[model samples]
Target: MPALDNDTVSKYLERYAEPESTFGARLRRHTDHILVIPAQDEAATLLEGIYPALNAVSVRGERTLCIVVVNATDEARTIVHTNNDHLLQTLTALGPTTPLHTQDETPCWYAEAKGFDLVLVDRNSLGCRLPRGQGVGLARKIGCDIALASLRSGSSRAQLIHMSDCDVQLPSDYFDITVPMSSAAVIYRFHHEPCGNHAIDEAHARYEAYLRYYVLGLRHAGSPYAFHTIGSCIATIPTAYAGVRGVPKRQAGEDFYLLNKLAKLGRIHTARSSPITIRARSSLRVPFGTGRATHDIARNIDAYRIYAPRIFDLLKAWVAALGALDDALPARAYGAVYERASETLDPLDLDRLSQALLTIDAPKALSEAAAHSSLARVRRKWAHDWFDGFRTLKLVHALRDTGLVDIPWQLAITESSFCRSSPTDTGTALIRDRDAFETCRRLARLEERP
Candidate 1:
């Protein structure tokens, strides 16, 4: 059962949901699970690749509701609009569709597919297009909001709202995996599939390697919010989704922000089920992410770099010191925190850490947090909340700006203590040969460890 009351969920949907799309009588039918996929100019992949993958999912005695939000901004190019129109036409021709309701002159349709109930949301039509600057984030919110409404109304047995993209092939056990009710969200393990294009495949390898490296760095640094935030690999509990006020309506980075908030609410479970295989293809979608990284890396792989290992060393020291704060300390206890942090660093690195901390105003922030709460646990919670994932990334950038600059991916991997201890060799040969795909495989193995 959902943790939120019907009135509360209804209010959230009314305010943040896509208008009039979840009220159809046909949508009240029972479903065991719900999966939302946001699509733009992805008709061919969604129809040919994703649809078959969803059908192959092994969900015995369970009905899955798959909502695909076909969206485009008003400023989208002609090619995008044409593709969306074609996608809608093709889907409508699949089988008879029950016309749900129209929002902003766009129609929503429901069709029963082989393994799932398909809800095709049309946000690409003339007056129904998404607003300028709102891209995948808005499209995702529309689909998820409807899913949440169904769950709240007892139309679905699931308390988890699954999110994915048309570019990925979900595993056979994707819907069968079990998640604890206490969890705020679950992030499925994923790997990028090698496309026929060598350049694109190599670029994806490097990008995926960089992502795993960053997360491993965070884990070594003792950060609680150390999970992957890929939008396509996440499933949020209904309560946590509502608690965070739903997904942000940004053009990009929605996954990062959503998981960041969800982490504070409860544990984020990482699934060990068969991994989702994402297609390795370059795209100009939205602003930045796997697509942008792939495009940039294929152009100049040498220019792509990861954060310096020294940066994570500094982060590790800071996090350790923060965790050591005591309630017995004075109201302005940042001095002790800084002292503990400095003890972990060499003299030269201490100066760099000091400068980076000063740049982020860590002293003042820690002082304020201590002053606000005398209870040790409360003070620590306040500090952690203040230094959330966004601030952590900002601190990393601040360290880069202060002194410790980003190094080549190969050098960072070899120099990182976290990678050095891995079963695979962290050698200079990685730099000499520039085997990015091999490096990616090594990092993926490291990430798969218990």
Candidate 2:
């Protein structure tokens, strides 16, 4: 085996030194798997999520390392300090630590069984230096970086990094699922149940339906990226994780950006195993996500809307024209291809998109097709890379600005084949009738498949 890159390790430690002391030299050099969970004042959620994970690892009969980064943002509203203290007290009450616990004077905790081990890092501890309000993005990044460090230290034999959150319930077979060697990431299926509030439950359901609708539209448009981006519903190999430079360090939408980059690397497999169950609750934790969107719907039911299905039709035509662009250049019909595509579009600002394309020098991209030469192939890849997932979403928004309005969720479904029957005018009726959302669920699942 190659020698571990000590310099790289040092850089990470220096950058995140506050939590470094808690890590110490406790990482196992080789274990069956490494799982990372980020926590922020989730004392209750931590216990709820950890138990099933431990149970899953036991069934696999492989020694595993479960690392929980107990973190909190600097915001006074957060109960991170209180929560971490409670977590430490709970760990102390669990049992005595193994030899791995001997090196740290800090309140780091460790407990192990025949095939399972748990490690806790207190982000609010005196030694921890994570910034205030860095949010889930920073928390997840810290945990994943620690996982990668374990792999490099030869403490873990596992190549995959399992990422999850505190609000989820894992199944006994959670760790039993595996991905093909060619896969970059494995997206687990997830289900949400009503949290007893009629209004909140209805809003959550409507938001989920919108999520599925967007994915279905992407699939229909022939975009390579059509997968879900839930933070807790994912697992990825170290190579892919590092290749993308780990997850982004943003307050929100970190999962979306990370998975977007991973999709460009290789196929993102959708596991059909037992799905994780997440509890639905309104939150303003970061900015936007399931929680925030749920809150939005509760406040104004009509405020939450989806892109009209016709937008997908226009997107399909636009994406289809890209392939023709390459061939058209070879035939010296590049301008003809653009004019033809412009005529087919309904709401797209053909002039604006065309201007954007020209600014990127689309002709140079066409002449540099990979099938043509080595240099051409590199140029072609760069060109495609330029028009990434974020850009595509921007284009969609641009169309929205140019008169393509977002329709109400219920209306969008009723207008399409996805919902054979319409629900009551209010979202409550549609949410209560589980069957009404089946089409959206099925379509999302279809897009999930490899």
lDDT per residue for candidate 2 within 1-450, as digits (tens), equals 122345654555456433443353456435777778877666644665657766666665667677777776556354657767687667545545653334454345666544567777666665563575467787788778767777766677775788988778887677777577678898988877778887887788788787777776777777777678999899886767766777787878999999889888778888777888877788877789998999988998767788877666666666766655444445343564566668776434575456545554555545545335445445345545655677778767766665668988777765653333323343343355455235445545555554
**lDDT (CA) for every model shown?**
0.81, 0.67
Task: Kindly report which residue stretches of model 1 are placed more than 4 angstroms away from their true locations once superposed.
Answer: 1-8, 20-26, 51-53, 56-59, 102-105, 328-331, 421-434
What TM-score does each of the candidates earn? 0.93, 0.82
lDDT of candidate 1 over 1-450, digit per residue (tens): 236556657677767666633643348668887888888997654745555445664246667888888999888899999999999888776666887875444588888766678888889998888988889998888888878888877788776899998888887777767777668899998888889898898888989888988998988898887889999999998878877878888898899999999888888998878888888989887789989889989999778888998888889999999965665355447788888888888988788878888888888888888778788898888888888999999888988887688888877887887765445655554565456777776677777776
In candidate 1 the C-alpha lDDT for residue 405 amounts to: 80
Q: State which candidate has the highest TM-score.
A: 1
